[model samples]
Target: MSSLSPTSPPPAQSHALLSYPSPSILLVTLNRPLAMNALPFQAHWDLSELWSWFDDSPTLLVAILTGAGSAFCAGQDLKEVQANRLQPPSQPYLKGRPPSGFGGMSQRKGRKPIIAAVNGVAFGGGFEMCLNCDIVIASPRAQFALPEARRGLYASAGGLPRLVHGAGIQIASEIALTGRSISAEEGIRWLFVNRISKSQETLLEEAITLGREIARLSPDAVIATRGGLRDAHEMAGLEETWARTKERYEKKLYGAPNMLEGLAAFMGKREPKWVVSNL
Candidate 1:
């Protein structure tokens, strides 16, 4: 239940968004309720900093991102964009433009897991942000859409690509082309969301539970497993990928302190103490 103020320290801000640290999880919130937790120019930068902070934090094994108010995020602040003051070439919109991808979601390569707790509507870039998460849990009122198509643009910041990869090309095409929203139920049905909860509190509780479970595992094993999956997806053929994986497994992760701890804990009937180390 410990909380950190928005303007507390480095990588922290005084705005609506806040970052709170738990034992093994970092909870980041979009705190602008008046604007439905919309992403302002500075908010994007804050997000990038948040991701970077999490990447270097060894105690933080997982992160849970959610909105402060009822709405998760209405997407980019169109007012700022229209005024020509939103885009920062420096941050690259925190996307994969030059530095990181949009909101730092698309280009992040951290080993820690991220879970998106969709409290309400996740539209346009908001939906794209959810797509970047490793897992998504939504409230029953949560709705997802890529409405950029209707506005003469497209959800290019990993939305189209991730949707196609997660929910299949045909379904992603339908959603993008039609600019229609899908309910939490429909999202769960399509496997786009892992779970639908009764409320935001419940959704976050479940996400934190999952995060703690992940934290209990050996950190090295978790990171290596994520790398293996990413490699398998990027490369062709399982033969070559598995060969490379075996080499890394033997030469690196296996026989590590965590592995020995796991074995000893099993033999001694005690809880395993996972040794955290930077990879």
Candidate 2:
């Protein structure tokens, strides 16, 4: 791993994104507010690259994805998409990228967790991005929708599947078919969002607190648990899932240093100092 630089050049302007480090968390913000932080062609590629960067950086235990200005993300920039001038790259940005998935949430699987801070409206692709996160904390004013059906397009980029997986078949179908928007409160009721805050600051604070809590746990354990859950969801029978989970515990997590620290801290009635070699 490389040393953390105090100063680093901003991500390419075409990318127009900002990455800041906070303790064990990486704060990723979409930076093109002029377009309502709408994702352009390059933005998708940049997001893919950013996810890879975070996966490689061991110090970054968690990521908080949010947008700058008023909108969490206004979905793909309509003008850019309609123009069709920007051809897809010869190679997919995420091809051969770490399995932590697209934008770190798609097909990728990683040890670290990601939290989405939906400070404002998340529509279409933006809403899908929120679904990709392990946890979502939304501001009270935030709204979510999948307007692709109304626009004569479909959110094929993990939106349909993730929504079904996260919010279940019925709710996902309603959102996709009707192209209706859901309030932050409704999002919580549907289990799409973990919590709703009164404002952005509170939402972000809650995200940071959750990230810190995750960071304090055994990294291996966290990864294994996440992987197990993901696999279990995909697998057929409970026995198979349990077997895989047992394998992970026996082969990886059991008796780890962090586990020892966790036990010692419990006995000593103090906070544990989690030590992870690979970060």
In terms of TM-score, which candidate is strongest? 1
lDDT of 2 at 39: 77
lDDT of 2 by residue, 1-279 (tens): 123322334345464455554565778887878777777665666666666666666555678888888888878777865555466436554222234333435554555578899989899778877887788999988999999989898876677887787779999999999999899999998888999876767877788788878766666667777778777766778999999778766555667776777789999999777665332
lDDT accuracy of residue 136 in candidate 1 = 92
**Clash number by candidate, in order:** 6, 6
Q: Which pairs clash in model 1? A: 6-13, 94-101, 95-100, 95-101, 95-102, 96-101
Residue 211, model 1: lDDT of 81
TM-score of 1: 0.87
Q: What is the lDDT of residue 173 in candidate 1?
A: 86
User: If scored against the real structure, what TM-score would every candidate get?
Assistant: 0.87, 0.84
Q: How big is the positional error of residue 265 in model 1, measured in Å on the Cα after superposition? A: 0.5
Winner by lDDT? 1
